[model samples]
Target: MVLTDTHTHLYYETDAEKQDLLFQRCFENKVNRLFLPNVDVSSIAKIDALVEKYPDNCFAMAGLHPCDVKEDYEILLKEIYQSMAGKKIYAIGEIGIDLYWDKSTLDIQQTAFREQIKWAKAAKLPIVIHCREAFDEVFEILEEEKADDLRGILHCFTGNLEQANHAIALGFYLGIGGVVTYKKAGLDEVLSHISLDNLVLETDSPYLAPVPFRGKPNESSYLVYIAQKVADIYHISIEEVAAITTANSKKIFNV
Candidate 1:
């Protein structure tokens, strides 16, 4: 029952003092191996600090978030590269097209996504993608970039089966989150066609908390609930889902 949360924002307003209790709870539930994704320049310091504090438990990735892409993107991207320079960034991520908030940055977002993909290839690190209401746009950039040397996970995947298949075809893993536990999410249909080998479990903590605590701030300890729901959906034991997805995560992040 060792569950690995492949994606989470552990550095998101999470205090270092509370980390001990958080680790205790997660370890008690066999949830370890947390990966942190950097949103923008503002997050780089905090993310680095967290990783430094828990190098064994928390791993980090560096990239500019899509929502942060704007006129000042060039300056921010330079800062991102500076932070990642000579550092072992687990991935280039939380990066992709996000049309939900601001569509004005569509062109810049696409450029940033492609640039990050190039960096991922050069750095030889997997990417943790963030896509929302922009699958076609994201997929279009990914295809044009031809990221053959790049591979990663689609964090908080809300796409249909066809999108999942396309991502898989491009050597990416689907990141299943608390949304899957929602009865109305329609994730079960996508899960039916996605094998466990191509899936990884995540909580995206402080965000998508699973059912029974659906509206509360999420924690890594709640990853068990997400795993349980996935197991129930696939008609498999919780332990099986934990082991398989943990292995899948390790295989990708090389942890």
Candidate 2:
């Protein structure tokens, strides 16, 4: 039963010193692959270093996070493109609109999102999207940019069934994470209409830890709890969930 954490921020300053111990814990728990998504230009070097440290176990994606979008976004976008020119990035990720924090840069966020979508299409890499309270805004850009060639995952997905179906129709997989285990989280509604094949497990750690570890710092090993929650929601075995989602991750990331 090999579990793959399709999205995480192991490169964050908080996790810098715990890499070896984290990998050891994940190894013990049968968590084989850890996909790290870049936050912005500032964290690119740190992310590359982390990937270099555990090249086999850790893979990386390059992109400008939505929240990082500002007036000078073009400069950052150029940096993102140059950084990924010939790199082995698994996805052009952690990108999309995030209105939860500040709506002031909504315009810039949308522009950055569309531009990165073009980047993803040109690079032939899947995208890892991050949408907050801006589902409508995110979908609007996706509808405009998502052609027959564009595809990716909706990282940290928390939308309703309609949004889930909309994303799936465009050939994107739903990135299930720790939020699914929340007591009142209505993610099961979305899961009820979506099949496991179109679903992939993630932790988005060290951020959204699952129940029992909820409110605590999350790690790759905690993905097992997420897998268990998914199995319960889908009414299947944990091994089956792990197998299918791991395969889904590989299929999208081409790992």
Candidate 3:
């Protein structure tokens, strides 16, 4: 079975030997595809290097993460937007409003999010969103920017069934991650009512590790745990989850 991690930060692992082992574990687990989303300007090079090293398995995206938005963000964001000039990218994200970290930056975050959305729309690329405790805020912007071609994955989605449906209505696939395996995350319950067609799998790794590795650093190899949890929810085999979600990833990333 070929599994796909629709969103991951595995490129953050810089050691050559260690990064190889990480890819080994991912491949050994049948997690054959990984999409890397740049969190800030600095991550562009890291992501480019990894994708260049593993062109067959890794894809890259560019965007300034909401949490990274700050005063003087316009200048930095311009740099990020321009960084996409010579590189090939599948999306313009991990961008969206994140109210959990700092409500103070909400205004700038929204502006950054909208500008990135414009970038994606102009490029005709899908957007991988990074919504966190700001569904209402994010949805408002998405609603405003909603267009026939406005489609992508909502990375690391942890919302209720209503929000899931709302996102689907707005032309987005909900990105299910390690949180689905958490006992109290309620994501599994939410997935019970959402079809595989409207869903995709992710690890968001080096973060949100699944059970058995919940409190530890996450990696793409652990995507199986999240897939298994999703399989259990949908009453299907892990292979089916892999097949469907990987297909969903290809539909989103065109890879």
Candidate 4:
């Protein structure tokens, strides 16, 4: 069963030894493809290096994260726009309004989000969103920016059935991650009404580890656990989950 981690920050680990070991475990578990989302200018080098090292396994995205949106966000956005020129970025993402960390930056965050959405559409690529306690804001922008060419994943989706359907209606796939394994997350129920075709698997690794490994650093290798949990929730085989989600990933990334 080949599994795809549609969203993961492999650049979070700087140690070569740890990186090697983590990737080795991922390979062993059939978690072959790891999509790395750009946080900011500082993370670009690490992300580029990882994609260079594992050209076949790692894919890179170019975008300014919402949390990283500060007063001087225009400068960062300019850099992001320049980086996207003639470069092989798989998506424009991990971008959206993150109200949890700093509500003060909401205005700029929405501006960044809309601009990045324009970038994604211009590049004719998919977007990977990172919405945190700003579903209404995110959905409003998506509604305004809705178009035939606009499509992507709602990364780390933990919303209710209505939200799930809304995202699906807006041409997005729900990114199912380690949160689904949480005891009281209720994601299992929310997922029950959704179809596998509109879902993708992810780890958001180095964070949000599954049940057995919760509170610890998450890894791509732990994707199997998330897949197993998803399989259980859908009453489908883990292999089926892997196959469907992997196909969904390939469809979005065109890889």
In model 1, what is the error at residue 180, expressed in angstroms?
A: 0.5
Clashing pairs in 2: none
lDDT of 1 by residue, 1-255 (tens): 679898887777656578677778888999878888999998998888878877888888999999999899999999999888776788898899899999988999988998988888888889899999999998887788765677899999988999999999988999999999999999988998889899999999989999989999898889999999999989999999999999999888888
Please identify model 4 stretches exceeding 4 Å from their true place: none
Clashing pairs in 3: none
Better of 1 and 3 by lDDT: 3
TM-score of each: 0.96, 0.96, 0.98, 0.99
lDDT of each: 0.89, 0.88, 0.92, 0.94
lDDT of candidate 4 over 1-255, digit per residue (tens): 899999998888999999999999999999999999998998888988998899999999999999999999999999978877665899998899898889999999999999999999988999999999999999999999999999999999999999999999999999999999998999999998899999999999989999899999999999999999999999999999999999999999999
- Summed backbone clashes in each candidate are 0, 0, 0, 0
- Best lDDT among the predictions, by candidate number: 4
lDDT accuracy of residue 57 in candidate 3: 92
Residue by residue across 107-217, what tens digits does model 2's lDDT show? 889888888888889878899999999989988888878687788899999889988998899899999999999989999877988899999989998898999899998
Model 3 global lDDT (CA atoms, 0 to 1): 0.92
Measured with C-alpha atoms, the lDDT of residue 129 in candidate 2 is: 94
> Candidate 3 clash total?
0
Off by over 4 Å in 2: 13-17
Q: Give the Cα error of residue 7 in candidate 1, in Å.
A: 1.2
